[model samples]
Every structure is written in C-alpha cells, then in structure tokens.
Target: MAMPFFNNMLALLGAIGFWPSVVYFPVEMTIARLNIKKRSLKWLGLESLNFICFLLTLASASAAVRQITQALGQYKPFMYKA
Candidate 1:
C-alpha cells in the first residue's frame, strides 16, 4: 500500500518537472517548421529569460515545501505534549 502511494507521488512530481520542457520543444519545432526567419533578438532574449524564471520558480517552490516538511517533523514531538 505504501509503495504504491510513494510511486504515485514520484510519478506526479516527474510529470510536473517534465511538462515545461515538453511544451517548449513542440513550439520551437513548429517555429522552425514554419520557416520564419529574421526574428528580433529582443524577443528571443525575453523568451529565454522567461524560461529560466519558470525553472527557478519551480525549483524554489519545491525547496520550500521540503523545508516546511522538515520543520514540521522537528515540531512533531512538541505537538504530542500533555
């Protein structure tokens, strides 16, 4: 029972981690397929900046959740006091 729950959780995290890159790939491919050229550097730069921001945000949020869980674990004994 516990193993299945753990596996499901891991799978969920994997999907969340995988989606942004998966989404970016097809859109980039489609852009290339369209044969559009002579794009502005400003637009490309901004897109790259946005992608970096997204990855950082996800990473920070995951870190914060982990930290909160760790803190709760520390406080568990105190909660059981009579």
Candidate 2:
C-alpha cells in the first residue's frame, strides 16, 4: 500500500508546494513590488511562465498516476525479483 502510494504522494507534494514557493509567490511579489502594469509584456511573460509551471506540475502528477496504475496490476508485496 505504502509502496504504491509513494509516487502519488510525491506528486501531491510538488503540486502543493512547488507552485507557490517556486513560481507564484515570487512572481507575484516581483510584480507587486515593481508595479508592473496589468497587461504589460513583462506581466504577460511572468504569467505565462506560471502557467507553464502549472502545466508541468499537472503533467508530472498525471504521469505518476499512470505509472502507479500500470504497476498496480503487477504489484506484489515484499517479493523482490532479481
């Protein structure tokens, strides 16, 4: 159970933490402190970057889910194959 859930848990952690800490907060803070205009090129770029990061996160989570599902059928507890 725990073994199968490891990847899912990792995906959840990254989705929850990576965006806010790595992209969202820093980008928003930079915009706010610099007074970037709403529709300006720089603002658009930053927002786009944020969106890209979000997509990456989504893709990773989906991949993890896919991997777990595929492995689940063959999963055997404490049965090591050399």
Candidate 3:
C-alpha cells in the first residue's frame, strides 16, 4: 500500500526538480546573451559554467529519485511468526 505512494511521491519530486531547469535555462541564456556588452570569451565561459552547474543539479536530483525508488521497491515487510 505504502510502496505505491512512495513511488508516486518520488516521481513527483523528480518532476518538480526537473521542470525549473527546462523552463529557466533558455530564459537565462537569452538574458545573459542580451546583457553582454561585447560578447567576450570571459562572459561566455561564465554562462557555460552556470549552465553546467544547473545540469549537474538536475541530474543529481533525478538520479537520487531513481535510486530511492529502486531501494524502496526491494524492501520487504517482516512477518511475525505466530
């Protein structure tokens, strides 16, 4: 009973964690591009670094949810001997 609930909760968490990057990355890149004065290599490097960090965070959250779900699925309830 609780297993399904936990799986659903994990799925929801993963979705929540993933969506912001999907929506924010393009907007962030656009803003960064627009604000750059001269398109220097330094500014491009910083933007790429920021995007990489965001990708790492999103990947970590997704992997965590996957691991937790798999762990939960393997759990067995202990039965008492009468």
Per-residue lDDT of model 1, residues 1-82, tens digit only: 2232344346446646663666566556655676545356644754575577567657755765675565555553324434
Give the candidate order by descending lDDT: 2, 3, 1
Residue-level lDDT of model 3, residues 1-82, one tens digit each, is 4453476466657656654566456646765777864457766665676666667767777776777777677666763335
lDDT of 2 by residue, 10-70 (tens): 7767776777799888999999999999999999999999899988878877777777687
Enumerate residue pairs that collide in model 2.
Answer: none
Q: Which one wins by lDDT: 1 or 3?
A: 3
Clashing pairs in 1: none
The models' CA-based lDDT, in order, is 0.56, 0.82, 0.63
* Model 2, position 64: C-alpha lDDT score: 73
**Which 10 consecutive residues of model 1 have the lowest summed lDDT?**
1-10
Which residue runs of candidate 3 sit more than 4 Å off their true CA positions? 1-38, 77-82
Quality of model 2 by C-alpha lDDT = 0.82
Per-prediction backbone clash count: 0, 0, 0
* Candidate 2: Cα lDDT at 73: 70
